[model samples]
Target: MVRGNIRGSAARGGIAACCGLAFLLFGYDQGVLGAVIGLDSFRKEFDDPNRNLEGIIAAIYDIGCFVGAIVAFLTADYFGRKGSITLGTWIMVVGTILQTASFEKIQMIISRIITGIGNGMNTAMLVIQSALIAFGHPLSTFMGLASRQAEPSSFGWRWPIAFQGVFIAAILMFLPFLPESPRWLVHKGRIEEATDVFARLAGKNSTINDPDVVRERDDIVASVEEEKKLGEATWSEVFTEGKNRNISRVLLGAGPYMMNQWSGINCLAYFLPITFERNIHLSVELSLILAGVLGIQYFALSWL
Candidate 1:
């Protein structure tokens, strides 16, 4: 039994790691614009001199995020968490390609919107995935480790976006091995499949091959059945009845967290090269190397 528990924990940890990859993509997308916009080519391409256009381009991405969040909330219940995440991955791929190919500021703005949508959807999916994993297994430790290692280097923004594409592909490949949330399955009235998933996750070869697995499955079924008999509202109905009020409150309260991005620290760090070259009278290459060192310091602080 102890061995089985260990195996089960490991499997869940693997799934959480997969979900964390998605989150890392989200973070990379969030930070890539800052890093790349500081490059001479990017500024010259956009014909931006005083850095005014940078804020507009960045804000467009945030606008896209607003749209994506609304869409994710509406579709998560209908499509299921895994399905939504898969869709988000496709969006990320297309957005990355568009951004990479963009030659004009307007085109890049559109691409940022596309990428922002993907990021927002993936963020919602990450929360759902975390909750699902936490339901059946202890995932705090895995999540902590994953969060610490999410960011990569600051060479160029393209590297991070390209890395996102690679990780998204890896996630899609690994999704087939993961069990869908049994709670979601049960809610959808897929009792037998839910039981099988639970058994598999618990390391049983088959649902019928293990007595403890059978008992656990029965418990879940019975609990879901009881809830069904109580005529609990559908997601939409619950939302209408203020069931989501607390969630809304929490989200609203956390809005200030996004302000951290605009706190000037990241902007200064990103443009450290330009700042040094223009303000302190340094060479571009030397300024870039200094900027990199400062970026490393910020990245290290993220882990702390």
Candidate 2:
């Protein structure tokens, strides 16, 4: 870890900023293609792929994301939170580069999958900052407009895709300087380091043995120990109930997300501009513009 002097709320704020940037990047990537996919230039370049192909192009990223999440689930404990995040950021950088340079439909599909994997590894979003993803929609619509050149230039679409790198860059620049997840540290049996992190989080003058820090550290360690007593869960055990109600708890947590996919917000998020043009019979310019306006409203309202 790149140790720094920041402590208390300042340190916490820095951590929050990094996470916010990541979510913003995630939102931007999700929304950027929504408008771009509807662009005349993009359509022309890709030979106006049928809706079925477009769906695959749009949805394949989530497949990569699923793979990434599973990978993180299996490996995060071994890598630690910071390590996983750092590794994922680098993977995203590669993915973004490939995406921005894509010249073929296949290339774009592969690059997006790679990018999704990276985002999945880092996990998802924070509540209020989750709006950054929505905010990305408008920003992407604006950037997609860069393709309005009289002569067909790919710069508009490429630039927006490339812009994802800026968020990733911001994350990489600051992440190394911040502390790792203290819980992960404790899980790895590094109590002293975890204690130091808790102390640092507590305040500038706090020490590993500070009463409040010790109490917090001990509490976490105790929690970790208690969890270990449950033993490692096998797949069969996970699906069946013994003492943990594992399957029920899993369903409760996953049900909302499953319903969300069913709710068709993703339909709006991924295809709003296209839907407006094709379904509502709006002009292309008006569709893109309205999509952006709606994105702004989504961002604003998410705070509630």
Candidate 3:
């Protein structure tokens, strides 16, 4: 039976709050790198590797992320969205800790990979990020500045990286209380649970057969039925299924994102301060300030 409170505002609020926070941490991790890569103390410690090396250092995260995305799809059938997200959070916490504690290049790279894996898993379940996740950019920038100012030491980069776990902890705290995705439950043939979750999320305090709840639940169940009619879902079917040309649709959908990732946009986000300071010959202080501004812009526009 659905928990009496499951359909209350509290449950929906909990879902949004936890998911938003996790996404926020993911964004902040992405943004903080730009600042971390350029810090004077960090550069001095690591001898300011060349652009290619720096690129490799940053890009390896994507490698792990790619692997994680595949793993997410493969495992999601069994684990469900909530399970995947929970496991991802644990991996991210471990990754964030290792990243914070790193003292060497390879260690940082490995940690980045671990962190990316967690992100990839989380994203697979829920890719919607806007206002909340956007905070990651500005906060990362702010943390960078704070770290710099606190300094006679290297705490600037480390602290921002480390604090990522704070958000992760919040997510984990709420996970147990949250309902699994209704769609996932439906797909797994847990119709009653799906109906309950749908009603709860919609803030409707209604019975299993209540008109509104039944309509929504039936709509979702119909989709699952359609999939069942199409033969067991498999990689082979993805390329051959549906009048919409499923493979083409998938390509159409993912093409832009694929292009964007390959574009140098993220490279700039991760290493903007370094790029400005090194290539443009801007003063380090000035470059960092500009990077912070860029973060602010990203944050504001993310809501759009």
lDDT of 2 by residue, 163-184 (tens): 8888999999888778888898
Cα lDDT tens digits for candidate 1, 212-259: 777877788888889879884565653352645855765577767667
Ten contiguous residues minimizing lDDT sum, candidate 2: 122-131
* Candidate that would win on TM-score: 2
Q: What overall lDDT, based on C-alpha atoms, would model 3 receive against the true structure?
A: 0.80
Error of 2 at 174 (Å): 1.4
Question: Each prediction's TM-score against the native?
Answer: 0.70, 0.94, 0.90
How does candidate 1 fare on TM-score? 0.70
CA lDDT of every candidate: 0.62, 0.83, 0.80
What tens-digit string does per-residue lDDT give for candidate 3 at 2-107? 3346566888788888778877877788878777777766766567767777888788887877878888988997998899988988999888988888888888
Residue ranges of candidate 1 with Cα displaced over 4 Å: 1-10, 128-163, 204-304
Runs in model 2 lying further than 4 Å from the true structure: 124-128, 146-151
Better of 1 and 3 by TM-score: 3
